[model samples]
Target chain A: MCKNALTEEKFRELDSYVDTLPEKHGMLISVLHRAQGIFGYLPKEVQLHVARSLNLTAAKVYGVVSFYSYFTEEPRGDHIINVCTGTACFVRGAEGILKELENHLGIKSGQTTPDGRFTIDALRCVGACGLAPVIMVDGKVYGRVKTGEVTGIVKEYAEV
Target chain B: MSAYRMHLLVCGGTGCRASESKLLAENLQALVMTAGMGREVQVVITGCFGFCEKGPIVKVLPDNVFYVEVKPSDAEEIVSEHVLKGRPVDRLLYVEPEQKGKVSSHGEMPFYKKQLRIALRNCGFINPEDIEEYISVDGYQALGKVLTEMTPEALVTLMKKSGLRGRGGGGFPTGLKWEAAARNRADVKYIICNADEGDPGAFMDRSILEGDPHSVLESMAIAGYATGARFGYIYIRAEYPLAVHRLEIAIAQAQQMGLLGERIFGTGFSFDIAIKFGAGAFVCGEETALIHSIEGERGEPTNKPPFPAESGLWGKPTCVNNVETFANVPPIILKGAEWFASIGSEKSKGTKVFALAGKINNVGLVEVPMGIRLREIIFDIGGGIRDGKKFKSVQTGGPSGGCIPASALDTPMDYENLTCIGSMMGSGGMIVLDEDDCMVNVAKFYLEFTCDESCGKCTPCRVGNKRLHEALTRITEGKGTMADLDNLKELGAIIKDTALCGLGQTSPNPVLSTMKYFWDEYLAHVVDKKCPAGVCTALLSYYILPGKCIGCTACKRVCPASCISGEVKKVHEIDQARCIKCGACLKACKFGAISKK
Candidate 1:
């Protein structure tokens, strides 16, 4: 878990979104997504809230959220860096990029920076095999990224 | 909203993105604005047009003119001639070889004519995130019908009558599973959506979840209603964040719309979905293993027949259906079973969504009728092989599927047709292999995947697969004897016959398929000590032709193994003992100096 947990404002923001949703039987997932978007991590209290709101058990809600990798319970940094490590990317030196990113950020994939500026993660496929060595910072995709480019990319985010 | 103008639907699939589709869109936009009919023209960036070889695709609506291979430079001409002057861009249009001088609309493009698009209905049309858009297109109406009017039994009967089978492998009847769980004597029943698609190159479920997530949610709720289950769980792999995110949003929207939740449409029936993530394990796709993972175990398949329908998920009766199977439910209920039953073959009902990948041109998501011929999909729909490469074989059903050689291209794709030809439709992953791909190497690739992803619960999968991989590794390295091939076949059969679960049972498919279809490649490796496709490092040697050498020293400079010894302006010689065959020399050579033999 990142040190910077969900602030009260973020919780309120998520609550507001949840309040507007119709009380559907399958709304637990939607609630968790909203919580993750606002809080960066889904805290236990929010999970309970989601369960209560959707008329589900907290265990059930936790089970669903915990089942997928996209739902995180730890605060992420300002930038989320996802490196594609699928078959094509792996064959095209994506592992080298991951190693370089780890060295530069001093954190492994799935961990947020201590100062909370970047969260690095490895993905199976971003569905962009034509651009084998691909990385996405935020929603912008940078293709054919090399190990040499890792320093400049991380520095740009860290300095921000 | 001026009715006098046209609509240009551009394919924005990932493949098109690679072909600078974004640039095409930009140029189209600029051209539309400059024509002073911007208000009349609607340039919509739609998801995958499916005709990928001739992409980035531009489709003109109202008239429905299809344009293929639209580059950025051609954008101005398309806008100026097609949109502005109402003249077709003849040069940019897809010229069908059979059609001769005639170009066709998207529907007339043979790839889509034979196909049905039930699972992919909303994919290329709707903005995936906007609930209102989905609603306008009759998204939650099925939920409304089920909640307000239909009884659980009625819904299940509709599904059974529709003859819908699970699209995510096994081909089990969807309604039967629900009915079994409904009949089971359990206080707390559950519905599980198996979105933990672990098949290599399979993305049909993920793409559906990404493009039209609400359908899956609606289907799960429908399943919940039919089975009398209060809770639903979608066990999607952690690998698909986009699917996960979209699924979450769709659930929220459905809740907001009163389609889900307690007293849905004033009915006492209620079912809510929660997501469970599988942490990079392929075997967890099995129902028992998935249940164990949801129970926070290490995701190893357990003994069956107390089958999930009878006992599952904390020891309650649970019904598990794949994402594609659930996706077929609402439509069956809405359109009636006979409508779906009428579309597909006698045994298999409705459409199957295949992740059309590998050496084909239009590598994207495709939903075809169950009986559509492989030739139709690969040649007609996929735009043939890229750059006119001769097709070798098409590998269906991921690692578990067999390779169908070019001779079998005319075979129809259904549960029976695939299984009859030494392959099973495990999940819809169709990888087209070209002539350049070595059969031995292809088998080696699938074997390697199974080895790493095997759960190691059973000796057959864990150990037998390791042995098969070693033989393939040996064969690919040009060191295997004829005895090794015999050993490979024996071990593969053993794993298939004795393994406890589906993972082990189907682990031998790649080797079996390649051996069946590309035995010559294997013979070449063993008998001739050569890799036919120049893929195996041990059978290949990098040589510099004295005539082609420009004395660039690029190969010598980049050799990580330090085996290439050469001076400037001179031919280079590789020390084969030190060369690890990483192919750095092949990539670094500028003057075609390096050739592999």
Candidate 2:
């Protein structure tokens, strides 16, 4: 579903990288991680290329990718706002925060906004429950976030 | 080295860092430099202090005086008043909840009084990135002692003599697990650090790895020498980027220093470690599932007749241990078995670290000796319930654990006692609940997690948990009858009894525990069709208290549904039929007129 298949530049990089790893048994996961890193999200085209390079079935690669929540099958937005719905956050009004985000972004948790600016994802507890009602944009964390502050935070990111 | 008489150690843990401890660190350093006492005063940024409610904590050295809720603005006052004039910033000092006085030292504070840090010994004390800081605190001496002097059998005996159980939920004896792996003679055996902690509120493992990674690496090498294994894999969650980043630096530094990879301490034994990323599967926390994950499979658990110790990781013997478990190893070796054994209760040994959160004043990581009562943890260490609310229940062990009622407040927190009360001491995620929290909703929250994370290989966990979630959903949505409660009870018991893996077996804990302790709440949901805590949206009804309504049209303006219609300065009324019960109007009402009934 990508624009073409893989570009010549991307193909050469991937092919050489696969040669460096063991193709026998345990290198599929490593290759998949690298592939996902190279192409922001793992589309079917990339998965197929990985299968061919590693000499594994596309079904095998797809099975592993679909099993984990980290790998995505589609393209994501520039910024993914992960609001922690972990037990502590949930108790500390995380749902309200999520609802506010959904309204402001004009999309649900899984869907990327039409402009491809932001995507909302609810993650399980991130072990920072001490900062309950926690949200992370990209990798930076915003703690003790209140419902009132949601609009200002989103406005700041909207320009970016 | 500069002669620094006073050392101000600040909390650099994730929780404190989020609250601007970095700014506080920078500010303190700036103020100290400006005062021309830079050499005489050292401002060091360390890991968590476990008193997170009162963070950006700055603990002064030599006297052990702990300052809480330290701001960047307070740095100048602290330096000028305290460092220069020999007087503490009384406003920044932590106020004791019990006595309402100026408690100075860490020991006098209720939060740190009962805590004894062993696994977290180096955290909040030294810089985790520095190898020399770790070495100064007797870090790699355990690996050195084990490699040069003691035999494999002697070390296992010492581990067994000390009553150190695995801190990773199951309370499996660490010594016995190592001995089993050691018995099976395999040339390419592997040692695994189970850093894939999937519990929602838990972060002790992440904190240990982020704050003190070398301790785990040193202990892993010791494990390799003892078990006749040369390769080790740390199966860590990918979500913890900071911990992962720190671990990478630590491993490279250790390998460069000749602590890991090829003949550690110049002995004949050689060991190496590699990082294997876990891609968001909670079931991988199980050893069998973890092994499968490493092998690039679906991370599904199998029957344990071939237990990981006998056959694991490409069919070779493997030894699996949690991060906190390995962290305790070096100290155990340094201070002998008897010395470690004398710290805790009969069965559980060494101090246990808990990620204490929810409705508690001091929300942070705490480590206390085993057999300490919940009263000490909740009231003493946790500084009681937040906003002066009444304590309802405490959920231990995350999604796999059960809730202990307020009646069991004095219950000693150990593996056996928690199990006796229908909960297990799961990787130390102690979330305190207040009176405002609904027990039925709490049970639903955990069931939702288990249902989503069930490996789907087994029927009881995959389907049974889904059914249990549906039953709970019906109850929360005010669509359930009394008979559904029996259905939930029967289904939860069956899933607990017949599910395949440890994850499947414990999946129904939240439901079963709530059923046992909060049957009254469940009965109210079914019989009365009301949520006492006003949490369930389906059961909530908006009512404008006419007596309290001073009516500035505050609720009317923000109402998305436009249900609240009233004049400028009169009692406002909510149209019941048009109301969607989003609670936006309730939050907007400054006069406290809108209340959910």
Candidate 3:
């Protein structure tokens, strides 16, 4: 209830944004993007609110959410680390880099740290093949990342 | 119009931007101002130069001096030496890998020697955010020419004669697709630019959208005119923040300039474009799946024949084309179809943009003629394999494509030839592999991707691909029988025959192609339980060579599993049962005592 009260303003902001859209026929994906942007992750309450606002069933919204990998139901950490597992990176020793990060963070890919400080994800490709063996810490790309340098790179965010 | 004598074009592509080219641009601007050459010099941030191997690239006009690997600190030297004294910096010039000489001009570099730049002509040349820059390069002239001078039928005929096929993996003729859409009767229709770019190692589409977005938009409007569609949508990936930003600016600029909005050129034909963001679904790269995603569905594909050309996007006729496909349209409309068809091989006309990556010396986007040999692309244009290593194989296409071995290196690259070699040009992702890469493991990697990305709509894609992936996993884990190889072939053919969508049908390519070319690698894994490349950890064992051991404790000290047992000044031995195969000992061994087989 307290969480609800805290996020009431965010829901209102989302509602007003939905109202401003010219047509709502095929705006579910865009509206959900906006909702996720506001709420960090989509809980049942947010999905219900969106369903009610858009005159859609809750099952429909949940189905759409679960279908896309980008949408998450659970909350994430302060920083998200995405390791590039694309072919270009894979051939250039991306698996070793991923293993190093897992050892450093004490968490597997797609799992958040217990302290909620970092979450690591193995992304398919971010399309920066020029910089093979790439990783992104909160959307700031670091290219040609070596296995030994993984610990040092994570320390910058951990310390802050 | 301006009194600026020297123009500095800094690469602002995603690759260079990752290397902090933004800061480099700002630093160059500040230094130019400090040198009191603000009136004489101008610094402009342009899109990708495609020379991403040696970025951040800075090109100076008038002298045509190209600098590579430039840092922010180099800004002062550039403004002072190059801008003021008119002398080019020697240390920053790109040294040819073979010649070992400083190549100052971009034209002299071998990387740019055997290249064509129709789709990417304006990428490194102009600021993508400026409409004036695009207009100056004859960007929207195609749209004006189509709307005023030519009729819809003439445009369709011109496209048919051009012989341009889709650059998005499938070599479907673009002109024929437009003709089908034009034949359909509907009051409301749609034009979709497929910018999803779902290929794992491909970034050409993203580069075009980031570098010359107006070209795509103008072509989309032209497509709308040809197909009788007044509304358009660009289905793009949300992960591409920079491309999305540039597109928003390009659309707003075009609309403000009366080029995109209603009654463009004050003609009766009107067209408008809006962007729809994709939420990380690779299956959406398919036209039907892409349409469903735009309609806010689950991005799953349905059967075709009621193709989007007939019924699409709220039950309206729609024509969907890839970003590279649309980028090639304006040029075809401006230059006659025969002029465009004169280049490249028969059946597949014009050049193709390939994202050349992985194990290659030059890992960047390259646009070459259709009939160019794979040998030329890998050796001449790509500067050969990195570190002078022996060439093993190259994986063309993406997960849906196959690997071509060294024997097929001379095969001319085109839709027919690549398919004939058991590999399709899927979205033009050419990933070169060296001797260190394991063919069986590479096949397993792609199967894993397909199993994950499959929409799970049809059983062949959902369950059949899963079974194939399981067989691949077992082989890679050294727990396979020779019978598994036969099963993989049978199951792969079944999936290809019965799968509903393009993604599912082509999902078995990686396995089939690798089986066809690298059969010995698989036989070794199944019969001898040895991974020839030593990539599969389950098939590898580490040991210390008694001859090479200097009795050093380096390997023992760095062993994470504590499996290496030895004392100071004593030869070390690895406990086979306890060794985790992390390879830390091999890296830590200073005397080269540790080896894996």
Candidate 4:
């Protein structure tokens, strides 16, 4: 049932980490956190491995992975571009900024580039609405960004 | 800290940090040290000062001199003029929009004058990462007092006396919920602080956790002691990395100091708290959904007759309170219940911290007494709408909230009054919409959020909100029919009455409230097929003014759709059918010839 999602080394590491957890009952969330940290994103095979270790159903693990917006099954790009679509940011022109990014990168939201260098996604709020129309390229935050600036921001991470 | 004669507090909250306030802090500290005032003067990076409009704020202590829009370059002048020569920099001082003179002290400023800070008491004051700073401001004093003196019953009774309602949209009485959980005897009960503040513009919970993590930890431990529970969980959002870091540091610091984790204050109670990260879900803001999420399951709300207080977490009695509500607890226990309850209106007591953003001039956070007029918050604290524009509406309660129009600006903003006006206190996200904002578009925006966020658990929220968003989209695209309006009102009522959780029930608030107040705007969208605020692009058509047109080929060259055609230096004509409405032609026109109607 594990399906050999990971190498023997990776599997052993995950097993040892799970062993360190104080309680085993509700450790799926913590395990998921570690999996995401290690693999960047959770694939079906990886999720199956987690379920097998935790003695949980595959359906149960998949249900959780799909429920939260944070957990993604697809492989992420090298740099993830997060555009804040919070009400505050939206009103202050996040839509146009997103459109600008889409135009510059030749990709829509939730889609990665062919080169797998960048992926653009719109978030509900990063709790930084005070700086509306905010964008986070990787973990670096850019705020008060004008529509004209989107191309420059995208160009910085463009393929050489 | 005591050796320093004066301290320069630079705001290091998310808002300020975005504007390079951390760099400013470093420059100030380095500049201060360069001047040989190393031990005498200290530079501290504090949390949000709340007035983010003129953010990257630097406040000098003792003198109470406040500076706005402070830059890293200004560090040289500030250190030389203020520290060495003992003179406040006049150019760097915060200039009141109304008054001509400098507003030095933060207290005298119009923005903070009408406000009362209880939950946000230490937000702009203390260094959030430093436990010592939180301690200096009397942080964990309440936890000590509660553990030493008050019993579970007595603390619950005191909370009941304080009349503090849940700040997390529900507005449920905090004390009553605690009493319910305390009454239900269990071998192991649970206390969960709902830091899952999913509301878009609302960052008050995040601010409290980032600014004063101890208050929430202390409050949770107090809840554990009061509710006869030994374990607690703080379900915070992972989006707030700064708050999460501070919380982890604070939790570890508390454990080391014997504030948390076994035998608190040398008492018999052994209450400990752990951090549980919420993977982005708006519905999880609901208590039942939150409980399910913590259980490592899909976050969806179930029918609640046997509420979380009766049976929660692992089928044991549990108490869940909002972050702001928990933040208020430590203060309530520190000061008497009467003192906490004395402020605000008759029904609602104490203060509410709002993440005031959007068209407001002062776009940050503000804590004001309940029952305070909307006019006061909008005009006084918020510094009125941005660019001196006419106030359109203020949306409260996130997606679950309705808009309060400019006509009702004078209305009191307590829970009951807000509900009466088809709005709620919501997690205190008072996003001010200006005349530039289209009400139809605004309603559509909120509906779109709820529709995407609705956990498909119930038919009403899942299908109903989706249909509502579809209808709004049709209207915005200038294809709405008269029947759509009727369908909206009817469906909104159904969703409100039948939805399983609090989130689903209030999902239609934006639709209902917008239609109620801005009826004419909706009618305009349906009948005239025109978005009054020029927000809807489908309703807009680009036309060239013959009189102003200089036959510039710029319009034709830039037009991606190849719809614009005319000779060079002549009037360009755009084919209505062929036009993509991308606005490239309009932007290309330098003579102001192209205009969209």
Candidate 5:
């Protein structure tokens, strides 16, 4: 398993954090956030860690994490890129930009580059409709981005 | 002694960030460092501050100086004047809409005056990545209470008294769902948090998970305790990378503290959580479909005779709740159940988190009491329509719900109230529609989304939604008869009645609601062969007004269709026959000559 993946010791570490938690319910989110910060993903051992920490059964943690669209277990790349494909962005040429990024990165949406330098993702809307064709790189947004500029923009991040 | 005792909190939500809040932070940090007062002056990048119209917001600690719309260039002046010299940044202060030049803090802002935020309590107060900050704010108190003081039965009773219901489309009593799972005699029960918020223009779940993942995790643990569940799962779409990352960190923190594993709080109970990734299938938002997807099957909803509570993951009794629903659990537990029941209307017991997006003055996440009127959310909280445009309709519940017209703005925003008015508060996505929005095209837009997101598990949802979309498309193109309208109503009702899952059942809501409220728009499309809002390409004609035409040849030069032929400073005539109604000339026109009718 990768270092980002979970381990028995990591599970213990997460479990210890849960024990220190004053409350039970709201801690799952924070615990998961911390786990990801440490392990970079919510793997099985990490999930086990979360379950033990929150005083929840593993299946319960699994069920809650699985039910939501905001929890993941897969290891992500170093840098993440999300291109908005909202109504406003769609009306603009967002699809062309996304396609160009996908081709340049040699990976589809939800996949990281083979070198683990970048992960490309498509989002619904980043609320920058006034500046359509918006792309967010690691929480920093670049608005009015063109398809032709995608490769150069991504390369800057990759080289970084 | 620490040189500077005061801290500065800046709004760093997507909205504020878009308005150069990060740049502002950088400038302030740089200025503070240069002034050699960096150690004492702490800057915290917090979540949504709610008064989005006045963002990027900056709040000074101790004095509580709330500054609104602070630009990057203004940051150095704020630091130099406020941080170093003890003078406030007067110019960037928030000016109230009603009282011009009167500045106020977030507490004094009218947008937050009438609002009560439980789900959004920790959002703007804490750094989302830090568990300690959340802990200081009493983050996991409910989980501790549940584990130490309350039994499964007692917890269920408290929930029942609270009248807490699912915030994820279905307003089913949360206590009852827990009770169902509690009553089920199973060795391995499960709790599921439904974070797969697939509704169009919806981000309530995403924001909660991002802003406060700990709350959801802690609540699910409480649910596990109440329902006698041995495990939990959070089924989130692969899209929300930030939320996912935060959740992962929270889980690790929980585990490290020994709150999750065997013998938590010296108790014998043991529970664990895992995350399952979604491929952006909208239908998976449904409980049964979600359960099926988690079980390594296709994400399609099965019949409810054996509901997930009866037979869920691995054919076990499972209690499933949405992200918003789970978020409410901790508060209900910490604060008495009756305390939760006190707020909102009688039927709905608590606040609802809505993504107040599209043509609204305040386009961000908002949490309001259930009984609050749509008028309050749209006009007051949302600061009314953008650009002084008249409000036409507001689409709630994504593509599955109906368009609520301005006449129904006073309607209470509870589950039953919204449903009674031909709209359901499905996932709390309220897309504000302006006068420029064509109702016919709006229905078509939602229909198209439904058709695409449909899981194709049932014939009614798969085929019926597509046909409805086709009819709406036909009407938009001015090629439909009144018969098409009748057919839509008939087909819509059938899909609702016969569809196996909620996706199909509510898919026809937009078409039905628009037909009821904006029937004139539909009639204009069919009878007059015109798009009243000029949204439908086939029904629209781009023409340059004779008097207003500058005849600068700008329209002709920019027209991709070559549809305009005119002389300079003379009457410009658009060749309507040749015009594709692309509106290129309309956008390029300098003298406001072009018109689409």
Candidate 6:
């Protein structure tokens, strides 16, 4: 498929970057970060390529990938919605906002919509406690969000 | 140096940036240029002003007028009136909530009155991306002093005398950590700056990294010199894009200025630093786990005795320190240990930066001296509870910490005192909870966090925490008996005793402390099968009051389960058997007929 060729080019680019590193012993995490950036998510092939490039076992690569909450093996949607559920956010009624979003999207947290338009996830804290009950669509932060505003927020992203 | 007539300092912190402070800065700049006061006036986007409650804040120098909640449109008035005509904007000033008067200067504000600024000294003042701005404030002087004037042993001794404890909740003496690393002779020693601030409600570390990154960098270089390490790594969180970008710029600027990388000031000491990104793991805040994470391993903690100082980071002696702890280093080297020691209580020296959030009136960052009373932090500095709500408890130290009840408001906040009262001065996340928040739900919330974050390396942490979370869940769901309460206590104690790492050891603190203080609430949940705070939806039942019901059919139309029955203009009744307790009807009713209990 045409998509496979495009992905191969990305793989070559990742390989070139891995080759440029002076030391490869402790560069797996950094390489995986780059791989995820390029591919959007780390699939089996990408993880295998990273494992081969870093001289790490595929199991080792998978172990590191699965250990961190930041790394994901599955493909993500175009827009990722992260609702802050930290203590500050929780106390400030973030649960109501999250529930509203879950109902609006008809998908639970960590699951993408059927159309693959948005993926909702819960963040422990983005260190933006000053703006309690915060959410980030893609990377743009929306702070002090109310349950009534959840549908309007999703509509902006959905239209885009 | 061009001496500008006046300077406008804008808050460029994450909170303010979220509120479009950057656009406000650009607007101010454009206006300044248009007024031809570009040379006469300077608009600098500095780090967090600490008063994030009323951001985006813009402060005017020379006059020292502090303005809060500034919009991009307000930039025109600020430049036209404040900057051009030398007249301060009256409406934009921070008003004292209690006094009902506008406070002109930051010094006069109650939010900053009781606060001390040591770690956050250069945060709001200096331009973090510029090396010259950092140098202007005696920035690398400590590194220079340590490198040229003092020997390695003397630097270590001076640090030991400073009595600066680790601010990352361990409260370990910084000097002793350095001494251990210095004592262990290795060819390739390392200095790691732990910027993996994982506490949910805390952002002080990110603020420091974003606002005054050079402080942490300068301290790390000094730490390297003291420990005789040539290479260092700052393991920071990847989630903080602004902090990561600022640190990259700061490192490049520092390297170009000969402050970092290779021989500094033409000394034989050669040092360089690199950044390692953490991929969202809370356990990586632990030093040993952090070391493993840097080595590209699954960030799991190994046992102590072979500590990071003894054997770490490829089995070499490594000195790992927290961002806040390292930020305190440069000042201690510049000002002697006694001067720093005199500021706080005897054991806990210097100040602690706490991220005051949740139901507090003024939710922001405040660095107060140790031994300050909790009431001072909550009432005086924080402006008391938001919406005039009754303060129930304040959760400190994040998930690893416990809630302090209102009775302990007068208790002094130090390492020992906090530990004595079933809490630790964790990474300083002070989330104030009001009477509306349920204590049982709060305990469950922390337990859920710990259970999800547990690395599964130890049995007590992985299995025991899951069980504790289930017990807490049972209590919250009104399905718990008194025996479940006993099981929670017993399992919590066992987990504390048998857990391998600090993450597991202190995980049950929230549950235990809440049980100790709010046992009556828990009893009400288990015995009466009722949630006193009305937070547990499973324990709540909705009823329509006949006195207030207008029969508008609003509740009937909005009910997802179609459980509400009655015609229009007639009193509606919710079918008790079919009611899902979604509270949709309660929210939709216009007459305020619905009540939950």
Top model number, DockQ: 6
Q: Model 1 chain A, poorest ten-residue lDDT window?
A: A22-31
Clashing pairs in 4: B397-B426, B550-B569, B551-B569, B551-B570
Question: Which candidate comes out best when scored by lDDT?
Answer: 3
**Could you list the chain B TM-scores for each candidate?**
0.86, 0.95, 0.98, 0.97, 0.95, 0.98
For residues B1-597, what per-residue lDDT tens digits would candidate 1 score against the true structure? 235477877766655666788788888888888878778997766655555446677888787888887788998888878777889988877676655655757777666776679988876566566677677778777888887888988888888888888887889888898899989887899999999887756667776776677888888888888888988988887656667877788788778777777777777877788777666677788889888877755577888888898999989999999988877877777788889999878899889988766676666677888888999988877778866888888888877888899988888789998988888888887878777678887787778778877877789999999999999999988889999999988888888999999878998988987888788889999999998877677898888888998788899989998999878888789998888887789988888878998
- B1-597 per-residue lDDT for model 5 (tens digits): 135597888776656777788788888878888878788887777766755556788889878788877888988788888888988877787766555756546667656766788988877777777787778888778888888898899999999999998999989999999999899999888999998877756777877787788888888888999999978999887666667888898888887777676767778777778787665678889999888767644577889878778888878999999998888888888889879999999899899988776777666678899889999988887778878889999889887899999899999889999999898989988888888788887888778777777877689998999999999989988899999999999999999999998888998999999999999999999999998876788999887788788668998898888877868777778787888876678777777877888
Candidate 4 vs 6: which has more DockQ: 6
lDDT of 5 at B497: 99
Cα lDDT tens digits, model 2, A56-131, are 8999989999999888887788788999998889888898899999998889998898878888999998767878
Model 4: residue B539 alpha-carbon error in angstroms: 0.8
The candidate with the higher lDDT, 1 or 2, is 2
TM-score of 4: 0.97
Candidate 1 CAPRI level: incorrect
TM-score of each: 0.77, 0.95, 0.98, 0.97, 0.82, 0.98
Question: Which residues of candidate 4, in runs, are more than 4 Å off?
Answer: A1-7, B568-570
lDDT of 1: 0.79
Shares of reference contacts reproduced by the candidates, in order, are 0.08, 0.65, 0.73, 0.66, 0.06, 0.74
Candidate 1: regions farther than 4 A off: A1-123, A129-160, B1-48, B51-60, B63-104, B146-150, B544-594
Q: Cα lDDT of model 6 overall?
A: 0.92
**DockQ of candidate model 1:** 0.14
Error of 3 at B562 (Å): 4.7
Candidate DockQ values, in order, are: 0.14, 0.71, 0.81, 0.71, 0.09, 0.81
TM-score of 6: 0.98
